[model samples]
Target: MVENRPWMTFFTHVVLILGIALLAFPIWVAFVASTHTLQTLLNPPTPLLPGGEFFENYYRALTEGAKAVGAPVWSMMVNSLVMALGISFGKIAISLTAAFAIVYFRFPLRKFFFWLIFITLMLPVEVRILPTYEVVADLGMLDTYPGLIVPLIASATATFLFRQFFMTIPDELVEAARVDGAGPLRFFKDILFPMSRTSIAALFVILFIYGWNQYLWPLLITTDESMYTMLIGINRMLASGDSQAEWQVIMATTMLAMLPPVAVVVLMQKMFVKGMTETEK
Candidate 1:
């Protein structure tokens, strides 16, 4: 038997609405600011409603970009999209294979290798960036998509997570695959891959955002304006050294940058929840 309290239900709904408002308020303000002129935004107290300059502001941003950033907003967004997708897929693929080998392969020093990969979690990007940059420079990958994505693609966290999930898969399944005369790759392709869909969805969302927001590595490696990502381009767009900032264009760019990640989350919300919460495979 369950007791239903009307007041508690009402309070819960109130809290949920307030939390949503608090989070959404800033995004709403940004959208409104993006629809106005620089001069209009310069005045104190931003407008609550969207202004009339919606298409003009967005058109200028997509085509002309800001004065400080020479590249068009669309180009920067494309670069970000490429980098984010590459990093996400690359990390997931590599992590999945790495975890597969670690769990199933019986090679000597297997535990040692797994520990080596796991130890890397302690070394954040800042710590090994210099060496990584040198290696990338040596390979002549600077200003290329490979340069932006390759070094950052190897993720210990994803590897560890996939390994844990692989460990949960019953030995009976492995025996069944073997009984069916399936090879290593076939077993993985038929069984493990399909079973890991939800986990992959969750990781894809997270890794996509991580790659999309990467600033320091891309900034350091990319000298060409065409190769700049949304974050780098936005950073460059900030006014400095006696130059006046264009808040409308910046706001418009910000809004545009937010769309892809939001779409990914919305589309994958169900799988992401299952991946995070569901324990039994």
Candidate 2:
């Protein structure tokens, strides 16, 4: 056992190092590119390290194309934030209500309702995109915030996750609450909600990332430049045929677009891990 321990340690280090490189490479590349000038980035061969023109590139990206549909990266960022937050909050609320109903209430066809939602998990958004777009259009939500938010509000995954987590809580706790004359609403508010904080945090991180990185749906729903999300804005920036595309600007905008999801992950890393582990338990 003592002799074998050294081999195990060596293999563990090798695996960890490889994992770190796999995770860090893209982030390092993005950071380095964000600092390069357009000329440097677009040169015959791009340099691998940070360049001196980071602030200049960021400034030009923000101020250069004022009249363009997705110009002023800040506006696009704000639009993305509003849309992401709306979808995250709305999805969580809906999921919580649905999960609670399924878990705590005895009603007809409850299992059927859950099965229907589970079916949605098997279906990709792409498969339903055309019909969903038609619904949005008919509702007069096209090119609007409602169009962007409403389609994402019904997250079957969140509901399923919450239901599974809620199920793990001991029935005795809920029974104790009821025995004390606490109603269902009071039990949920005082006991269930507080107990599920870690799971909720995990779900929030997942949902926020989903909303932030969404591309195709937002692109299809929003035609108005003012309402464009950051992903759409970045795509539009890339598509523009100008004298020369600003690689630095593109990278900077990309980095800015990534910040919120990164922040969410960093801030909630502990809660996210705890939530996943606890739910499994």
**TM-scores for every predicted model:** 0.90, 0.86
lDDT of 2 by residue, 142-231 (tens): 988888888778878788788888989999998899899999999989999998787788777777787888888998988888787888
Best-performing candidate as measured by lDDT: 1
Tens-place lDDT per residue, model 1, 1-281, is 16799988899899999999999999999999999998989997989999999999999999989988789999999999999999999999999999999999999999898888878878877988889889999999999999999988878888988989899999999999999999999999999999998789888878887889898999989989999998888888885447898989999999999998788778888765664454223
> Lowest-lDDT window of 10 residues in candidate 2?
62-71
Quantify all predictions' global Cα lDDT against the true fold: 0.89, 0.81
Inter-residue clash pairs, candidate 2? none
Report the number of backbone clashes for model 2. Answer: 0
